[model samples]
Target chain A: MIELRNNELIFQFPKVHTQAVCRIDFQRTLRIPDDNQEYPLPPGLGSFPINHVDDFTDNLPATWKEHGGVFIPMYQAEALWMNFSGHYPCAIKIAAGKINAVSGTQWTKKLSNRPQDYVVVPDQPWLDGFNVSKGCVRQFVAMPLGEGYTAEEQLTGDAEHGGIQIIVYPMKHDVYVKYMEQHRVFNIGDEQCLTYAPADEMGLGAGGVMRQEIYEDDYGIDSWDQTSGLRCFVHLTNSAIYQKITGHPPLHKPPTAQEYTDSGLPWFDYYADKKALQGSASLSQLTSVAAKKIQKGEGTLDNNENVHPNTIKTIKKGRVVRDGRF
Target chain B: MTFSSYIRQSREGLKAQDRRFSVRQVAQRIGVEPAYLSKIERGDVAPPSEGKIRALAEELNEDPDVLLAMAGKVSSDLLAIIRKRPKLFAELIRDLKSMPDHAILRIARDVRDGDW
Candidate 1:
């Protein structure tokens, strides 16, 4: 089952496991400039408020009613990152408009380690964008789908769906308990119909590449409770359509990279030397928002350039380090 | 989420699945006045006692421990056990807090399997 609390989507599968509840918050952040530069992670300006689409059935389109899950407003060029926290080890599968963020393949119900279509958490604290390379991901920039820039349209060449789709398969109770007894570590519902119009709406597109890592699963394939999982569709509504549907403008408009740089807030760099997963060979071909905008020449960027790379804060990995007597 | 929001959403979620799980019916079944339960749901009043929380948890099919933890209360039964050796239990918890979850689980297992 899925529950929206404090602007976070909480997913749990009671029959599968009791303690496994995952909370995902969509974080609004500065859109890193797509200047072919690898940048650090950006600060979360705020979380966009999420509401159930069922609550606004009267105003939403028929397609939205058919895909009943949740909705969040996003600006034209705004960037977003998914922040994940949960009680147990689980496999999180992410897709942008039905395009897998990890492997850039079509959405699948089963967990596949052949190409590693999902990321394991709490090793993966946040996902910024499409995992294009081993240690870098293109930032998730919100754009109106169907212009052929989003990872979805670029991969499938069709903008049938315009939102983020997430499926969480938590560890089985026995496996989690046994693993906890041995190791102390850490430690979801149904799907909906699959029909959507190609009408222009907010969808995530590949943007600037950032330094991040998607860790390989440690629990092995059989550990996940394949019998049941929770899947949620997070619809991304563009500003105007969102206003017409919700009867109010978006609560927060995330500052652009320029405004954020001027304010002197810190961008971050996380250091972890763990083995990383290989990125999708197909996902590497998608274009960033800025690069695509420059090619199309229809819209202008919101002064998202001129970044100061030296000002970024480097976060050392939190592993226990030995201090030899000196 | 806070105690109030968690209770409200869980109730609403169950109500969405089964309309029989209404506020008034639930409040009456849990042995509290509808208005008081409503106030608790709205955060106007503090959460009820452990008995009420356990009853509500059973009614909503939720883990009693989760609800009790959200309400910032320990289960009375567990409290009674702790009260038996308060100082020793307090020290045990203080040390357990710093250890990893597996270590604590190991301690619990050893104690449960120990000869009385």
Candidate 2:
């Protein structure tokens, strides 16, 4: 099932012993503190409502009902990533536009491969579609739904498909223990079942969000491999509910490439330094303007601007990190 | 080279050889939505499991071994062997591909002199 807490989307399948979570970033620049950055979900702009696909039977296709899972609405070109945590171990399949976005050579085959849907593992955090490692792909990106090449049109009919579908399969406990043995480890709990790659290595520190977390410990296993745990299995069934919730609007068609460019925001840039502007005079003034706008209820808080001017003033006066922005 | 592209090419290639099967017919035979099959053909998704690939191969009258290799998988019987000596297998395939079909057939037929 899917649950949203403090803007973090969590998927818990207790019967399967897996929990997948991602911070829902409606705006790309929302910074998370080091101690709190827990999952592999990347920071990005835009928030979509995630709900069971069964509830919106009238809005979905029979095939979608067959998959019977959760869906999230996304505008064209809007991108987001998911971070997974598991108590046991599970191989996750990310179906974007109803197509498996990760696994196999879809990540390598050029003719059908699009940058929109791909996986980013610890070895290669930022996806260039070139720096891929065979088994460790952890992060999954669902590019804005509704593009001509996406599976959206066919999966949800013409009205829907502006979202992504996710399904998780837990590794059989015996298989998990076997994998543990093969990897020179005797038990599962000692490894954290979690792999950490720092925010900098993940390309998070560049400009999108400044996270204090660093991924130092590395595990040599790929949790996304389907064949690792079980040779044969069944598709985990959804509990059967697919209702569209508030806070997400239906797709009014995604933005055109021209419009996105005119807006002057690249999807994400890993090398750009958005943190150094704290000392710039222009940025200082911009924050003041931003604060006034916030007071007027038309705040540009979500925009790429690094810090609100009032927060900066407090930081300087108090000589401490205010609002968690460095 | 990918299972996705391989399945599609095999599907199209077989259909051209014997114009009897439509994508929908094969999809129905495999018990998948036509769109889902189409996505598999287009490499949008990872190739489905070996069972689905085998079913597709049988329906298309294509060789399952070729499809399975492109799918980056092997039968369970071969998995442990491959896992144990991946480099040896990789080299064996690399060398085998360079051999002519006649030479491969000659080696297959002459077991006594084939170093078996």
The residue-by-residue lDDT of candidate 1 on A107-162, one tens digit each, is 88787988888877667778899998999999988888878778888888887787
TM, every model: 0.68, 0.30
DockQ of each: 0.02, 0.01
Q: What is the lDDT of residue A294 in candidate 1?
A: 75
Give one digit per residue, the lDDT tens place, for model 2 in A87-173.
Answer: 333333344333333322211111121222222222112221111122112222222223222232322333233233333334444
After superposition, the stretches of candidate 1 with alpha carbons farther than 4 Å from their true spots are A185-200, A316-326, B1-116
Worst-scoring 10-residue span by lDDT in model 1 chain A: A190-199
Docking class of 2: incorrect
Compute the lDDT for candidate 1.
Answer: 0.75
Which candidate has the top score in DockQ?
1
Candidate 1 local lDDT, B1-116, one digit each (tens): 98989999999999998987788999989999989989999999999999999999999899999999999999998897789779989999998988998767645532010000
* Candidate 1: docking tier: incorrect
